[model samples]
Target chain A: MLLDDAVLRAIMRGLHITGSFVLFGNCVLQGWLLPAPVKPWVQARLRVISQGSFAVLFIAGICWFVLQTVDMSGAQDAGDIWQALPVVAGSTRFGGLLIGRLVGFTLAALALWLGWRRGAAVLAGAALAAEGWLGHGGAMPGPVGTLLLGSAVLHLLSGGVWLGSLPGLWVGLRGLDMAQAAVLARRFSPLGVVCVIGLLLSASVQYLILIGSPAALLNSGYGQLALLKMSLLLGLLALAAVNRYHLAPRLPMGDELARRLLLRSVVAEMALGLLAVLAAGQLLQLAPPAMAAMLGQSGG
Target chain B: MKLVNLIALALLLGISPAFAHAFLAKSDPPVGSVVHGAPKMLVLSFTEDLEVPFCRVAVSDSMGMNDAAGKPQAVPGHPNELMVPLNIQMPGKVSVIWHALSVDTHKTQGNFSFTVTP
Candidate 1:
């Protein structure tokens, strides 16, 4: 099947989010979870990952912008798209916000290059937060709109903390000795707990507003995509639980089998996280049941 | 606990309201109604603020000739309302077709008709 604009946009959104998660996730893992006095080699590996992630964000962000401008302008020719580009970038609200986000991304890159990992992460987080405005969360009006935007920001950052950190844990474990690996694992567990709670709570708030009713969850296309995302997250959580409760504890005792299993589980959790992100990317392109109902009403 | 702190933060920001999408809420020269004469302009009220440049309205008489004098413009101080001038001089069934893009980038379009009795 020919990939429609929505499908292409979804793919770009997924890639964009993956980049943000890795950038912000690495920052959190390095700043908060990993034991102080991190090895230079491990930091070097993370730096490479951060740079690669920045590249993904820039490329994917550009693709998403081009697609949205075309869709908004209904431009059928390259010349029309070119003409629309300046108007879109300078005149439209979405374009204005995207320009601001581009600035944020640039600052994040500078911070990363300067070896200010925490500052890079903060800038990345701000860029990700701006995404909430680009989607339905930003379209909402009034005080409730304020709350929805807040929930969107919380959800993205908390998710970044969890899904983004898996690679960090793996890289750290691979390079460190058994004792240090155990310490890293333990330190990460509490952070994971906090993030999971944040994700669930913020998601619930968004669901109530977006889905409107429980029945809609099974009925609407947006709701179905959301359900798929939630299921993927549940799978990730189960693997995480096994890694935390059953595997990490055994690592301290020098159980070779447990260490192997924990590493494998972390990889599996990352896969699930990526799939969940893809589902959410598609979900953003669709109007929720509540909004869809309004869209259905036409003067004709 | 860190979990409690995170949960509390999420709850603090969890308030929600109903959803929104721009749609034609109402229009002057009300749909399918009879107006004594050609109104100076047709006004469309939408449920959300619109991006004026992308919005347009076309008024066509029974012969399919365009009756709209100019492009639609947002009413001053009311971003959700669009006003388009009409060029009709005689009584007939006139159709108004419109396409609008809300400030949020949601696009919606529709058409309606009203009778003109001269």
Candidate 2:
């Protein structure tokens, strides 16, 4: 059945963003979180996640491109450079974004193949970086778009490290040697720290873009939901801190209670993160600036 | 735990307001506004930059026919604004109907009436 345009766009955007999260998250987990003993398993899992998500993203992206092509042909500004390029090259904004995505996708595919062949980590990193650039960061224009793009990059990276590490941790607990698992956890911690920092920076930038003004915090539905997301993230951060400083140390000594608590907390954090993602899906549809302006006028 | 589940449900339900869009901010020659001279063109302004090609603005006299001289043209430099020239030259009450697809693909349509004085 033919879907409504808004619904279709929302689905496309959600698929793209979610696929990105999976791709980056899995990579971070493999590179930083998995211990050396279980590195092979983690690598395999990352490959699975990356390949699966990319397949979905590539298909959805192509569908969106086709739809956009049809729409652009009939566009009133059809003759403009921006509108002509996807069909012509170096023509329009949409064309630029499309080209960026194409380049990024190609790089990512090649990187995946190389990674499977035990390619250099640096090469894989470069491909992933390009993937980030083309997916959301490269699509943005101007200072605001640049800021948004940067945030999107961090969001993908941090989300990858946090969410993507879970399965590996679960597997390590199932059968791996205790000392090896502990060592892995230790190695993963520093990467987690870096990912957290990136997440916070990106999220802050995104918040600034969305909120735009202080009044928006209380005015628009989008703003209110964003505040809720922030609160949830703060709670998640507190839980993460506890996991890192308190629970992680105890795990090496085989403290059952600490392990249980940590597991529960991580699950909760993941659940909250999913909720945040869903909220974000909704927020992207809202008219933040207009709503904020309306609220300002009403308040005055 | 039940309380938490209930709260989550409430939050999910409360999220209905997120489906907002670029509504018609205003229109020049306000809907049904009586004017002295025949408007040379009809103009519409939207709250957000609309995706062109899928948007249209049409004007018709009392008979409910299209009075547009040719295809509607997007206002240059303003993707949100659409203009359609009027072909009629008489003092008659005209109805203006506009429909547009927002960048997000939300379809919106609205209509207004105005009289052109001889």
Candidate 3:
């Protein structure tokens, strides 16, 4: 069967998303850190992580997407999948996006390896952005599908900028002075708020279409996982609030302790972000709430 | 960010594939074909796997008499293949109606007729 072992599929999927998010977050962090008055060594380390991930994640993403082709065609086994791959990828919308993502990720990875950061950044960003073209939105039909795809894309990119950037933000804080740390915090707070707004707006609309009913969240596996992702998002927001109101102001006054505290919080948020990404990977494997109900009622 | 957004939009415009329906891909007694004689089974193949409980196939004679066939079941290890046993004591133009629900929960249905020559 295409995904005979559910656990194996989830693990592969989780690793794929986490890998992509790592690259995305690191790239955004690199942007944030470079403008900071951090030590050369610290900046160099972040650059190394970002560049290396761009390369690693590109290959990983392609393999994962290839394996993921089972989602489009109802291929029951590996042999069936292998036979279906060329035709399915050639014909389907999902295949088209996967191919695009593969090409974009490859070029981005190569550019980064060749020390072309700017080009890599653009290409890598595009690669991640195309994910909306697949997943739940891809399954949906009509103009509603287009709308959902747009929302999902915005949601993912905003997340890439926000949650994906957290690790770098945590690491970048280590090398900054109290004032620079405060300035960095100040710079990120507004951006975080804006991104959060985007996340909330998109999420609410997505919930309406994808979830259909709140009761499904409790009854269905897909719903339960979505709840977990939302919980993690809430935790991240709490940390952001803590940083914005409490730690950020403290940093401008040279509070070394507050800088340390803020770094810890960012790390905590980053951990949560990864968890959310993990859940998201598994979520995509599931049928949406209303659909899951139908599957249960109908599948013999 | 705007460029990224623009690229996604440009790439996705008008590219949505109209799939998700479990349309009939083939059949045992192919649609509208003239069979040599009465068939013992009615088998339908779909574009995707069928939810066995929700998918069913009904065979009937030209006089609209229903076949007391075996309950529809997906051919084991073959998700897209559904087969129904037939009690074809007599046949003229055998009509087959099928309704299939894919695992993803998309529903589709259709019917076709094939002549069973004397």
Instruction: Judging by lDDT against the true structure, name the best candidate.
Output: 1
TM-score, one value per model: 0.87, 0.61, 0.69
Computed on alpha carbons, the lDDT of every model, listed in order, comes to 0.81, 0.58, 0.69
Top DockQ: which candidate number?
Answer: 1
Off by over 4 Å in 2: A1-16, A31-39, A56-109, A116-161, A164-235, A251-267, A286-300, B1-47, B75-77, B92-94, B106-118
lDDT of 3: 0.69
Q: For residues B1-118, what per-residue lDDT tens digits would candidate 2 score against the true structure? A: 3323432443455422211234566667766678888777777776545555557767888877767887667789876677777787567888776766655434456666778787
- Give the higher-DockQ candidate: 1 or 3: 1
DockQ of 1: 0.34
Residue-level lDDT for B111 in candidate 2: 69
Instruction: Give one clash count per candidate, in the order shown.
Output: 0, 6, 3
Please give, for residues A71-126, the per-residue lDDT of candidate 3 as tens digits. 44456889978976776466555556667776777686677667565676677678
List the candidate 1 regions with Cα displacement exceeding 4 Å. Answer: A293-296, B1-20, B28-43, B74-81, B85-93, B114-118
lDDT of 2: 0.58
Instruction: Rank the candidate models, highest lDDT first.
Output: 1, 3, 2
